[model samples]
Target: MKRPEDIAEQFQEAWNSHEMTALAALFCADASFVNRFGHYVRGVQEIVALHAPIHETIYSDSTMQNEVISTIALGDDAAVLHCWSRLNIGKAHPAGPHSVDTVILAVLRLLPNGWRIQALENVTLTNPRTGQPVLRT
Candidate 1:
């Protein structure tokens, strides 16, 4: 059984290393990703495709940190995790990295590929830039 801490660590590693491929591989074939900006993507293919461009341009020096708040095991095949994420978008601004807060809720299913992410949703924090709604690309 993979603990929430382990899952959180893996997520952190993926973000820190900017390992989009590895990160996508951690999802189930039909996994769903709901980014901070409320963009929802389903399946590994879409997830991978969508991340390619964003990973290329964004987060040039960003670091993602997630703190697990709770985990609820659902039966023997599924679990739900609630967490908070603080993203430090790197020093492109005069003020240096800006902090963005978010709440993430994810569903994980035990699969042959291990504990893959089945679904995810996020409640985003305010975007300091533009003062308008920040949409995840």
Candidate 2:
């Protein structure tokens, strides 16, 4: 099983590469997700469905910068992870639609495949940018 610390970078890498399949694989079948917009959904299928469109739009050219704030074990099969990330919207550059310090709390379980995320909830720590929400290419 991959340790929580080891798999953290994979998530950001998957997002940066825009590989939906790789991104979804990080979660278990019953996994749940809550995006930055505050919308919540259950099941890995739903999580991927919700992300697909967004990744094709605002998050299409985004890259993730993850920082693991903490990790606590829950028994033998699960662990709770708290982290923060900056979704560098569009090509990296000077101030634009900065994704104000997003925070995430995820529950991961030791599944047959690997350590898969079971439930992940995220919140935008601050409001969206005033005029621009994302930089264009």
Candidate 3:
């Protein structure tokens, strides 16, 4: 099995590329992902269907960097990830930072195939009205 850092980096790389198919390949068949927008997608099929179009259109050129704050093994085949990420939507360098603060708590399950993300809950760290950063619950 790959290290958690390696697995996470693969996910980030897939997302940064906006390749939904590749991203979907990292999930378990019945995986679920909840976004900061309060939307929940169930299963890899739904995840690919619902999750990719937005990134494909809006974040095609965006770059994402994530800091894995921590990871705790729930058992031999499962674990959780707490991470913080910033998305740079354009290539205009640091000044063009339309930073989207995020906190992701993901549940990963080892499958016969490989390490796959079973579930993920993503939340935004910002004030919706003013667009100022705020702590999420």
lDDT of 1: 0.76
Q: Runs in model 3 with CA error above 4 Å?
A: 91-97, 127-131, 134-137
Sort order, lDDT high to low: 3, 2, 1
Candidate 2 vs 3: which has more TM-score = 3
Residue 57, model 2, lDDT: 78
**Cα deviation of 28 in candidate 1 (Å)?**
0.3
Report the C-alpha lDDT of model 2 over 19-132, residue by residue, as the tens digit: 889888898888888887878898878888998887887777778888888999998788998887777776443445555457788889987777889888877664266633
Using TM-score as the measure, which candidate wins? Answer: 3
User: How much RMSD separates candidate 3 from the native structure?
Assistant: 3.9
Task: Please rank every candidate by TM-score, starting with the best.
Answer: 3, 2, 1
When 1 and 3 are scored with TM-score, the better candidate is: 3
Alpha-carbon deviation at 127 in model 2, angstroms: 7.6
lDDT of 1 by residue, 39-130 (tens): 88899999888766655666757888888989899977788988888888877534576777788888988876567788878787666786
lDDT of 2 at 31: 82
- Local accuracy by lDDT, each model: 0.76, 0.78, 0.78
Model 3 lDDT tens row, 23-72: 88888899888987888889889988886666755565788788898999
